[model samples]
Target chain A: MNKASSALSGLYLLLILFFLYIPIIVMMIMSFNRSELYLLPFEFDLVWYQQLAQNDQLIGAARNSIVIALVNTVIATTLGTLTALCFARYEFRGKRVLQGMLVPTLTMPWLITGTAMLMFFFWSGIGRGLHSILLGHVALSLPYVVIIVGARLRSLGVSMEEAAATLGANGWQTFWRVTAPLMAPGIVAAALFAFAISFDQFVISYFLAPVGTSTLPVQIYSAIRKGFTPEINAISTIIILASMVLMIGFARFSKFGGER
Target chain B: MTSSARRLRAIIGLSGPTALWLTVTVVLPLAAMLVFSFLTVVPVGGREAAFTLKHYTDFFTRPLYLTNAWRSVRLGLEVTFFCALIGYPAAYILAKAIKGRWREALLLLIVLPFWSNSLVRTFSWTMVLSDNGLLARTIHGILPFAPSFDLLYTYPAIVIGLVQSYLPYMILTCYISLQAIEDSLTEAAYSLGASRFDVFRRVILPLSLPGLIAGSVLTFVPVLGAFMEPRILGGQQAIMLGTLIENQFTASFNWPLGAALGFIMLAIVLLIMGLFYPVLKKHISVN
Candidate 1:
C-alpha cells in the first residue's frame, strides 16, 4: 500500500503547486493581452500598461499609495527597531502581555481595524486626514517589524552590547554604531514587509482616507466594482513584480540564510 | 550607581509609548464602537450623541441579520476545513522537500499571496468567474450541456477566492510545525512496522495539531469578518455578516446598528482565538 501511494504523493505535490501558481501566472499573462476584455486569448500587447499610465485616477491613486507607503515605512521601521531593541535587550514584567500585541494587531482583519480607527478618530475630535491614516498604519506595521528584528537580535546574543559598554562607549553610541549596522539587514527586510503591507491595505485606507484621498487599492476596488478591464490587470502585474523583486533583494541583502 | 539605575528606569519607560499606542489605536476605537453601539443613529449612516440599545435590539430582532451572521459563520468553518484539508498534505511534502537554496523560494511562494492586497485577489476571482469570463468561455467550448457559467457574485466563487488567498497562511504554519518534528521519530515508527498512515496519525498529526489550531484561528477569524471577497466576489445573493456590517455603515447609514454587528463579529473571532490561545503558547511534545 505504501509503495502504491508514492505515485499518489507525487501527483499531490504537482497539483498543489499548480493550484498556487496558475492564478498568478494567468493574471500575469492576461495583463499583457491585447484584448479589451480581461479574459484570456494570450495575445500580446503593452497597450493596457500604457493606458494604466495615462489614466488620471489610476495615476493619482498610485501616486498617493507610493507617498503614503514610503512615509509609513520609514516611521514604522525606526520605531519598530527601537521597540524591538528594548524588548530583546531588557527583560521586564508584563513582557509576555506586551509581546502578545503582535497577535491582535497583525491578525485582526484590516477592515475591522480601519472601522475601529475611523470611529476612534471621530470620538477623539481628530478629523480625518492623511496623518490619521498614517498613524493607523504605523500602529499596524510596527509590531511586525518588532517581531522580525527581534528574532535577529536573539541570534546575535547581547555580548556585543556588553562589550561596547565595557569599552566606555555608553549605551546610545554602542547601539548607533555597532548594533544598528549589525541589525541593518533585518531592518531592511522589516521595512520591505511593512511597506508592502501598507501599500496593499484597502480597508484601512478606505475607511480612514478623507474624501478624495484614495489609495490605489481602494481605487482599484471601486474600479473593479464598476466593471472589469485590462488596466487593473496591468497595475496588478506591476505590484506582483514589485513584491518578487523585493523578496529577492531582501534575500540577497540579509544573512538570514546564514551565508549558505 | 544611582544614575545608572535611573537610566535603566528611563529605558523601561519606553513601554509607556507602546501602551499609549495600543490605547489610542486598539482600545479606544473598540471602546468607541462599544459606546456607539448603544447610542442612536442619525440619518444617512451618521451617529448621534445619545445612549440607546435600540440599534442592537433592532439588529438582533431581525431574522435577516441572524441568517447572514449564520451564513458567514458556516462559510468560515467551511473555508477552515478546506484550508486544513489541503494545507496539511502540502505542508508535509514541503517539510520533507529538498533542503537547499530552493527552500526559501518555495516558502516565499507560499507566502506570496499574503502580501497581495485583498482587493486585487478578490477582483482577480471576479474576472475569472464573470459571466463572459475565460472559465465560462472554456466551459462553452467543452460541452453543450454545461450550464452557462454565471459564477461571479456567487457563494462558491467567494469561497474559492478567499480560500485561495488565505490558504497560503495555513500551509506555511503547518509546514513550520511539521518541519519542527524530528525525522528520527518517524523512522522509529516505520521500523516498528507502523504503516505510513499510522506513523502520520500517531506521530506526525499529534505533533502538528497545535499548528493546525493556530492556522484555523488565523484563517477563521479573518474569514468571519471578511468583507472584500464577499462583496466583490459574492454577488448580491450571497451576503455575509461582514457585508451586512458594511451595508449598514455605508449604505443604510445605520451607524449604531453597524457598530453592533461589527462588535458581534469581533466577539465571535475573539472567542475562538481565546479558546486556542493556550494551545498556541505551549509547544506540543512530539515524544
Candidate 2:
C-alpha cells in the first residue's frame, strides 16, 4: 500500500512540474525562431536578439525599471527592517492590529495598491513623474519587506540584546552591534525580494508612471499589445536567465556568509 | 530610578519610523483616494471637477460597469478554486517528498514559474492556445475532429492563464503549512487502522485549513482585480474590474469614475474579508 501511494505521489510531482515549466521551455525555444509566425516551423536566428539590443525604447524602459526598482527597494528595505524590528521585539497596545495590517500585504493583490497609490500620487501633484512612480513601488514592496524581516527577527530571540544591555551597551549600540549582523541573512533576502518585486511589478508601475517614463514590464506589455514580436521573446529569455543566475548566486552566498 | 519609564520611552522611540511610514504611505493615501472617489467628474479637458456622488451612483446603476465587476468576482472565485485544487495536490507532494535529495529539488521546481515574468508566461500560453498554435494542431493531429478549438481569447484561456500564474503562491503557502504537521499525528492515525483516505480527510485536511485559506485568499483577491490576462488571453469578453478601471482612467478619460470604481473595489474587498474570515476561522484548528 505504501509503495503504491509513493508511486502515485511521484506521478503527481511529475505532472505538476510539467504543467508549471513546459510553457517556459516552449517560450525559450521559440525565442530563437527565425520564422515570422512565432510558432514551430523553426528556423534558428539571432536577429531577434540583435533587434532587442538596438531598440532605444526598450533600452529606455529597461533603464527606468532598473533605476526605479533599485531606488524603491532601498527605501522599502530600510523602513521595513525598522518596522519589523519594532513589531518583533516589543509588546504594546495596537500591536496585533498593526501586525495584521502589515502581514497581509506580503500576499495582497497589487492592483488595488497600485490604483490607490496612483490616486495618492495624483493628489500629491506627483500625478506623473519618476519620483511619484517610485512611491507606488515603495508602498507595495514595503509590505513584503516588512513581513519577511519581521518573521526573521521574531525567530531571533531578544536575549542577546538583554545581555548586551547588561554589559553597558545602550539600546542603539546593542541593536547595531549585536542584532544587526545576526539579522543580515533575513535582511538580505528581504532586500532581494523587495528588489525583485519592484523590478517585476507591472500594475503599480503602469498606474503611476508618467506618459514618457515606462518600465520593462510596461514595455513588454506595450510590445505585445502592438504585436507579439519575436524580439520580445528574446528579451524575455535574457531577463529570465539573468535573474536565475542572480538567485543562484544569492543562494550560494547565503549558504556561506549567511549561515547565521 | 526612572529605568522602567525610560524603557517605555525607548520602545515608543523605536516604533516611530514604522508608525510614521504606515500613517503617511498607507493610511494617508487611502484617505486621499476615499475623498477622490466621492468627487464629481466635471469634464475638464480629460478630467473631472467638483464633489458629487454620481460616479458611485452611476457605477451602481450602470449595467456596463457592474456587469464587469460581477464577472471579475466570479472569475476570481473560479481561478481561486482551481488553484487550490491543483496546488493542494502539488503542495501535498512537496510537503511529503523525501527529505534529502528530492525535497529541495521539489521545492525549487514548484517555484520555477514565479522566476519567469507573468507577461511572458501569459504570452507563452497565448502561443499554446492560439489558432494554428501548439494545442490546436496537436488536438487536430490526434482527435482529427475536435473542430479546431479556439481556446485563445476565451474565458477558459483567461482562467488557465490565471491558474498557471497564481498556483505557485497557493502551492508555496500550502506546502509551508502541510510541512509543519508532525509525522506522529499521521502515524497515530495509521496505527489506529484508519485508511489512507481517512487519514487525509480526518487528520490532514483539517490540519491544513489555515494554509488552504492562505493560498486561496492570495490567489483570489488579486485575481478579482486582474486586468492583463483577460485582456491578453480572454480578449474583449474578459473585461474584469481591473480592465474596466483601466478604461475609465485611460481610454474614457474619467479619473473620478475610475477612482470611484477603485474605492468600490476596496470596499468589496474589506466586506468580503469581514464576511469570510469568521467562516474560514471556524475550519482551522486553533493552536
TM-scores across all candidates?
A: 0.91, 0.90
Q: For each of the candidates, what fraction of the native contacts does it recover?
A: 0.34, 0.43
Candidate 2 residue spans exceeding 4 A from truth: A92-108, A165-173, A246-260, B1-15, B42-50, B143-146, B276-287
**How many pairs of residues collide in model 2?**
1
The clash count of every prediction, one per candidate, is 4, 1
Top-DockQ candidate index: 2
* Model 2 per-residue lDDT tens digits across residues B43-66: 334664677889889988999889
Candidate 2 colliding pairs: B40-B52
Local distance difference test values of all predictions, in order: 0.77, 0.76
- Candidate 1 per-residue lDDT, tens place, B1-287, comes to 69779757765665557657766878788778788788775322353367787766766798988898899999999999998999888888777744776666666667666666657766766666778876787798888688886988778888888788778889877887888899999999999999979998999999998888888888898898888788787777568788878777567867678788888888787788678878755422100
